[model samples]
Target: MDPKPVNHAAWINSLGMSFAEVPVGTGSILVAREETQERHLALFRRSRNQPFSHAARPATQVSWTEAVAFCDWLTQRERAAGGLSFRQRYRLPSDHEWSCAAGIGHLESATRRPEEKSNRLPGHYPWGRAWPPPQDAGNLCGEESAGDFPDNFIAGYQDAWSGGEVHARASGPNPYGLYDLGGNVWEWCQDRYREDKDWRVLRGGSWKSARRETLLTSHRTHDPENYRSDSVGFRCVLAEE
Candidate 1:
């Protein structure tokens, strides 16, 4: 059976999550847009160097624990409001799920390669595999970023943002109807980054990411669960059972 698309206004206006239904299962949900500062402020939290600018930018510098707590609070709030049934819950997407939504696993299947499993997991850059990321590809480090971190910023790319401009959510959606899957702020995934389990995996590179290597859809990094930075934030998922 085919999955259904989420009602855009419903999720954004109600939960502020802005969900997109992944093309798998009975419409597994992925937040279509990163949570913005205006949205997070409703939760009563502040990003790094609070009030640096307007509230339209993506919320950044949030700890994994705080992101998790937001999920918990949201779940409880929805349940209490009778918006969520007992079987439905909001939480962070697992590493595998994050990959699936990014379309990383199915990258080469379109070529009809025998080894390319249609059921393969995860995918890459929201705009696809072309180099020099197309205009509006995402909010990655650009000319201004080069001014601050010239050594790492992608050469010959100027994404319009200034050195001090706060990054915001993309104005459009990805091929999968998702946004900012390549660059913006790094998104927290549910998996423990290592055997020690002290850190959590972060997918999708941040505005500070300059190299194409770091912005690859499958690229991953980690930070301590309690650590927060201007480049880190997260989205939540709601699996409907």
Candidate 2:
């Protein structure tokens, strides 16, 4: 079935979030154009440490459980406001859905849940396979961040931002037009890192990520459900209920 039409402007105005429809298999899902900002979270009585206090900056120090709660809050808020159809809801994207957003869905593992597929395409950074990364690739640990992360910033890499700042939409969006899929903040996914482990999955790289391995589109990481950090945040996806 065709995806239902969404009033993108209304969503942004009411929720302080924007959505972009990204194709997934036979249907599509509306992904938040950027990471959830502090202002949006504050609307739901959720607040995180704001190093920059910029309302547009990505909300950080947010735990996985909190991210899920935000999704649930958004789902209910929209449903009650008549903005969402009964069959639709907000959620964290699955690992596979995130890969699709990153334009790497083709490398998905055949047998593993999308959350378990890791390091499938090695040596591939978000901005193609090139080394040292191109200018404006993302908000990675770069020369400008050396002062704060003396031992962690990339040796020669630099971007427009400074001091490891997590600017919302600072980096360009992926092919799917979803921002911060590479760097800015690590996003929480719906699945656990593995079936046996209780840890949840985190995708995309964060502003603190300096190593090449972590920036690859296929790279996956995990943390406890209650873990929170200044460099970690999440995006939301609107999908069929």
The candidate scoring highest on TM-score is 2
Q: Model 1 over residues 192-225: C-alpha lDDT tens digits?
A: 7675667788888877887665776767788899
lDDT of 1 at 174: 53
TM-score of structure candidate 2: 0.88
Model 2, residue 221: distance off in Å is 0.6
Per-residue error for 177 in candidate 2, Å, reads 1.5
For each candidate in turn, the TM-score is 0.79, 0.88
Q: Which digits, one per residue and each the tens of the lDDT, describe model 2 over residues 1-241?
A: 2223333432353666888877777777888889899878876753434333338789889899988987887788888999888898888999888877777775675348655467768877777777787776888888888888888888878987766477877777666666778888999998888788878899989988888888888899999999999889998988897
Q: Which stretches of model 1 miss by more than 4 angstroms?
A: 1-10, 25-27, 44-54, 107-124
lDDT of 1: 0.65
